[model samples]
Target: MSDTLHPLRVSNDALDDGAELRARMADDGYVFIRRLFDPDAVLDLRREMLQVMQAGGWLAAGTDPMDGIADVSRQCTEGDPEYPQVYHEVYKLQAFHEAGHWPQILDVMGKIIDAPVLPHPQKIARLWFPKFTRHTTPVHQDFVHFQGSFDTYTCWAPVGDCPVELGGLAVAPGTHNVGAVVDHRFSLGAGQLQADAQDVPWLTTDYEPGDALLFHSLTLHKALPNLTEDRLRVSLDNRYQAADAPIAEHMLAPHLTQDAPGAITWDDVYADWTDDRLQYYWTERGGPVVPRDTSYSDRGFADALARAKRGDADARLHLERALRRDPDSDRGRQAAAALQADEAPSR
Candidate 1:
């Protein structure tokens, strides 16, 4: 890995003009908006997240929730069978759901896409534990995983201050133009694509609360490893596309499905939420649900698994489709296990 860090071109001006904003996104693949959200509000959400972890005994005893000190001895590795169950609970937090529709974030999305924005109901909360390299997200594009709209934008915001050493996001500039790259197996998560840094440099920054990184679904990005000794790196990923565009049915579902016994449910997440306005907002709006493009079907399990064994980048997607197509079959179960071994978290 190169020690050189390239800073993302910051856009501080309000993006009132749709043409200019769209041009920047098309050209750079991402636009870093500084202080788009209230930092204090972001901190409150962070505290809430840490509280959930603390209550679950995931955090170190006698430490403040904000401190995010992990009890490593009790911490679950990415490979643990119960890791997904634990992650499911964290993903269902009400704070994360609320953050998905933050007015400021939606405003930017609306302007850039030049349409009424429809934020995806399924939000992703990345809780990267310090010193746990096994769960770090690999360099990959969101398009393959979220096959709804080619114009979909993902907004990544850290819940608290995140310096480079603490594992912020790094985007391989101009990779969106190259489209999806072949994926191979990687030690952490499912797999990652090796970037040609000489052609498309990796750009990143010391992200702070309220700072958001907005990028296209095809933009290739990865999380830097959490090198800190004790603190945890918590971040949120919310996606948006034009309201008129066709959306994948799966995107409308909850972030984590109740497939397993201990899985989190929508009711559990919304139990304390007094404001019901956000509940099923998209469904009520009557957005169009289109058939999901399953292009990965072309790469069958045998070929994918064979490639996976040799660390092919597309292995995860192929396995995922298998499970989606036949979750109850013997092959489906095997696919599920393979995904688990790869530590593929729910997007």
Candidate 2:
């Protein structure tokens, strides 16, 4: 971060009441801190995510094919091995859905969001994106690219120490309050707000494998190009929204897009009815991909679980709406269970 950045300070400690994390998010729209996962856990997840991507198959060209994984790694930390193709392959592995219910993510995330008091059923997944010279995420708000809205959090956790060489992320924090405005000259990315305007809370910090960074829906953020040859950047985006949330009309558009890639096999783990008629509401509520994406005012999350258990077709819409992102993930068998549960049961 430039020394000119706003001189605000965070506890950077293990977390007590979670007030510190919440306050920073409520006030700034973004927060960068360490300690989302342990060293060993981060290493393990890194290896697993890479392997999962390899198993998912790859696109003929372009990184968007691996955007989910790269995005997570960017939010967390990763480096590319070589230009054009740092990673042999990278993709959003469906396996991470199992991470949704992990105890580590639940206990830590629950504390931050004040769950139980808020009481969310909690869902999790890793959105991976691999990047290289030929494929880098263009500067754009996530809402611009995906069918989902910005009403949910995209908690980003690094699988390893994320240095600049490793495709570190740069953020224009607090600028999130400024809606999706184009034109870099007037955009925070260009750094030309008002003459007397406050310097954007810009930062380009290196995070350890276990560290995490959280950002809001409107925040201005982008991933650094993978300049490090041989290092691969693999991360996760844990999305969340309130239960019973509607499906984003934007997301369903893919069903309408002629050349859009194949659709995800949305599996509803909770017992419920699958209703394609149900809408997938776009959301951008969670704080960031790393910190506390959300904290409910009541037990809306609990009610959501009940709706899902009864066989709700749009569970993915709701789960993505209220998810609690996790860092310690290697779901070989665990992921299988989550995906299995997500499927509709036989009569």
Candidate 3:
């Protein structure tokens, strides 16, 4: 893909017309709305999230949390041993989860879906650090990560103003029209699976605090690298689907609960929350639960193992992290064997 990014078409004018909104979504595979949220409310959530990061030693000492100045030395991504320690703290914020269910978000999603919307219980936040481009989220469809239905939609919004250099999301127009999930391969980036975008043109913008980009589960998209010198890029990417649609079982748990040592349960996340309003709210309203398909990740891990044996640095690094994260698990043992095989002398 070229370094150039085309501007996203703004769909704010269609807010009142569900037909127009769904038509745009059908034609473009996405709807980008500016100021869909109150900027002040976004900034307030940014402060709350960043304050947690600051307390966890992610931000530069003495800097205001709202500034989001990273310390750099403390940088870690989703799979790293050190990441979930701080990430789960930010995850614990009541406001962080509430942002997913904001009425504006629900109304917009309801319009686009033309049905009652159910926000997935696994709310997500991307707390990215500067200069960590290798681990930037790769190009992929949401279905591979967030399965159960192709009708699912993802709403991504930056907590603060996000310029291009701070790693906001970009989507390939009309990619969802392909109608099915594309083949995905292992990647070192967030979600770990990457799709083949080939030559598709991508669209994005220097996102403001309240801007939202909503797209289909099959739409191709990726995060632009966070190229800033000393700042952190924080954003939210939450999933929604019709209230009656089937949802994967795993989507009901807290995000990153599968990661070891740093993993946290919903109770752990809710222990410090100020209210019970949103807690377990999905129990009554959640869609029909289906078993999560592990094929995507299983294939990705197999690819990583093969690449690691060939001395691919990124793949080897992924294997090493897996080994370190959990030495006794089946995949961890596979990773250890791959790394060991890679180091063996020639026959």
lDDT of 1 by residue, 115-195 (tens): 889999878877777887655676777776677878899999999999998888999877789766445232334323232
Which of the two candidates, 1 or 3, achieves a greater lDDT against the reference? Answer: 3
Summing lDDT over every window of 10 consecutive residues in candidate 2, give the lowest-scoring window.
185-194
Measured with C-alpha atoms, the lDDT of residue 332 in candidate 2 is: 23
Which candidate ranks first by TM-score, i.e. highest? 3
Q: What is the lDDT ranking, best to worst?
A: 3, 1, 2
Candidate 3 lDDT score relative to the true structure: 0.93
List candidate 1 segments past 4 Å from native. Answer: 77-80, 179-187, 190-199, 258-262, 291-304, 307-347
> Candidate 2, 175: how far from true, in Å?
1.0
Q: Over the stretch 306-326, how does candidate 3's per-residue lDDT look in tens digits? A: 999999999999999999888
Which TM-score value belongs to model 1?
0.82
- Model 3 scores worst on lDDT over the 10 consecutive residues at 256-265
Candidate 2's TM-score: 0.50
C-alpha positional error of residue 138 in candidate 2 after TM-score superposition, expressed in Å: 3.9
Per-model TM-score, in order, reads: 0.82, 0.50, 0.98
